[model samples]
Target: MSAAGSGPEDLARGVLEGGARSIGRAISEVERDSVTVPAILRRVFPRTGRARIIGITGPPGAGKSTLVQRLAQAYRRAGRRVGIVAVDPSSPFTGGAILGDRIRMSEIYTDPGVFIRSMATRGALGGLARATSDAVDVLDAAGFDPILIETVGVGQDEVDIVRAADTIAVVLVPGLGDDIQAIKAGILEIADVFVVNKAEREGADRAVAELSMMLDLAGHPEWRPPIVKTSAPSGSGVPEAVAALEAHGAHLAASGEGRRRRSLRARSRLLALLETRFRRAIEARAPEPDGLEQAVAAVAERREDPYSAAARLFEELVPPPREAAERRSG
Candidate 1:
């Protein structure tokens, strides 16, 4: 079992059986590493891969929260249990999260079929929580039909959420200047869906047209990502957006693309696991006394070349490049 299974599975089983307090406490424990989550995951992980993980990202102030709320409502009407993960940004000064998704989706919190969790970025890139994929596995096992992950609206860096989701939705507002330039080529290319929010504003069509034109230029394969217009506040175009998302989900099912995409996601998650294990190993080795400080101080005093000092530190603390290859071969 690869040295996994460090803890009892009874708690997680209780979580699956809809024990609310058990689920919450286990999630917190996993988050803080009070237990080895990776070990636990290996024991409990089974990829049903049925939930369509939809990632909604956009520039800040794009009404993503409202749009997600509307989407969740639509899914509920369709008779599906929905799981929502809203990733809010971390406060730079306090090193704490300022989570704010509850205000947007308050209507559905008490819904019998809906489960919502707001996770702070916790300084993870792609604006996802450090334990997001783990949490997604939990929701998936608990039988949530549609899992929606909403990231703090940022640019390309946050778009890495595509690796975690089956469909990627990039939200943009109407009348925003430099819509294409704002999104940049990096994240735009990965989108499976693009939504223009606040359709009531002026230049709505222009924004849509711009995105369409960009998509055309990119020559996206398999299927071109659909662009939808929505105004979540007034509930305009929400139905259409929902329809488009549902259609996309159906296509994934029929084309066997759902399995393929999730397999890719699984592979990505595994690589992340190995990387995390490696990082933990390195940290556990305990760095030499004042190593980083000595290097920095040396550079400040102009006593040695910074590049050479960095090379030396890497060699001393980390497995050498050649030895890493040897271990892999072994």
Candidate 2:
């Protein structure tokens, strides 16, 4: 963490110099929505867009964490600095991560080449923390190449990972029952690579065959996602998975899809930031009775419809276009 007196410029300078503590502090500020966030982002924005962001998502109990750890190890072997952001389900009582993914990745904690941060979903939808993308940018600016994001894997909504990662790998385990049902949960469309982990298990081949059949049915003409089998504990098949991811990266570049994805990412970030700022401004400027609070109470008491209450609140907080124009002219 950065010192209490350190300014945003100093913190940003430390982040650019690859100081792990500074990186941690910067992400903490982002998560807190600190007053200095805009300043820090301004300084670090130019240093971002250099890292490869990979999103690993899948059904629960599919060993996604192990795969992420293995992938980090493989990237480390290649002498690449790796950054990991693991989004865990929030604890209802504390609003903190329930089971930190870093525990499963204990081996890599000591490696100076690897930086890992575990984030709580904090009730955000889409299996990702709201601040996860910002955290990735912090790591990227700190010189980590190949940043890995592991989502909470809440089935259907996990597709949100596509907006955050350059390439997404959806992991599945054999013997999980009804593989088709899992695919139908919306992960099938977002996967750049399908990984059948626990390959030594009885139904590994069956899982692969089922995925292949589905891909055939879907017909991806531009680039078909490849399936790779791996047993992460023993590190078997990890190299092949890495190769498949690298191949996808190459295809994305050669086919111009990479630029398209980056554009989408930028758009998503802008919209998210705008939404956040609007909500904050509304709350901060609400009247003493708090327009939002009164609206909620009214709707709860059945005195007013939610739609009407929301419109009233918006009108109260925001001037109508004609009023604004007249005021400016006056």
Candidate 3:
């Protein structure tokens, strides 16, 4: 399909037909927040909500990429089509990804059953790219099952980004800095499955034990997260990890958390879209370039407060109901 004249309907049809080029274009629109995004997403929304979104996150050296590779292979072996979204850090100068995970996934890079896309975070914090969800939606609409999202590995505090996933696996390794204490507070709650990768390395058993203790201390969870040990390099324990993820998926579906999770994700996306729209509207209402500069200078010098300035701008975009009625009548 030609990007120039292709409307949302054409693009939606192309995506549902599982054409890689069409899906790539769809995700590009999502990342760039193009004018056609709303229409494209609206048309494709019904085709989503079927793929299992599983997130793998951890520190830089925890081997997340390798583990994701093995997991994708395992899924493909079972005759399931896999899609991977690897969120990588963007270069400061060019705003492109450095060390994209696709480089590391050379083995499966050519697999027809696997679709892999590396997304530059573009300064979005908390591990995930801002448009990662939209990209996942495109993959879902393309009929890929079990989409895997590998985060930028921002460690503990950034784990919240994985809340978008139906099942989150937090990868850990032995010999990392205070591994248990550092992650217990922030990652423990959101993690659905714990993976101790590089299991043959020193202190692997100890790491597993510490994670177990922390889970115990976190109190009784209705569905306790299972810890699976993996040596991704040798491809050991990968099946167990995959099984654990599947089991968690089943638990979520049976207990109705699946619906709740989707609802929460949708709510977040809606709020983000609203915030973006409002910001654009406010920018469009700016008086003049010089006037806008003066307004910023005033705020910086404390001559005007930010809240008042924001309220004033909002009033211009959306007048009060009574004021609007009076203007209409007059």
Best-fitting candidate, scored by lDDT? 2
Order the candidate numbers by lDDT, best to worst.
2, 3, 1
lDDT of 2 at 131: 74
lDDT tens digits, residues 119-144, model 1?
64455563243466766776776778
Clashing pairs in 2: none
Runs in model 2 lying further than 4 Å from the true structure: 1-5, 90-107, 123-128, 287-290, 301-303, 320-330
RMSD of 2: 4.1
Q: List the lowest-lDDT window of 10 residues for candidate 1.
A: 90-99
Q: List pairs with backbone clashes in candidate 3.
A: none
Residue 69's lDDT in candidate 2: 84
Clashing pairs in 1: none
lDDT of candidates 1 onward, in order: 0.71, 0.81, 0.78
User: Which digits, one per residue and each the tens of the lDDT, describe model 3 over residues 1-330?
Assistant: 543337777887788888887887888777776788888888888999999999998776678878888899999999999998877452221123324654555657788788888775554553244478888888999999999988744554256456668999989898764755666666666788989998999988888888788778877457888999999877899999999999999998998988888898789767877887877776676666534566678799999998886776667678899999999999
Q: How much is 230 displaced in model 2, in angstroms?
A: 0.8
Error of 2 at 307 (Å): 3.0
Better of 1 and 3 by TM-score: 3
Model 1 ranges off by over 4 Å: 1-8, 90-105, 126-130, 286-330
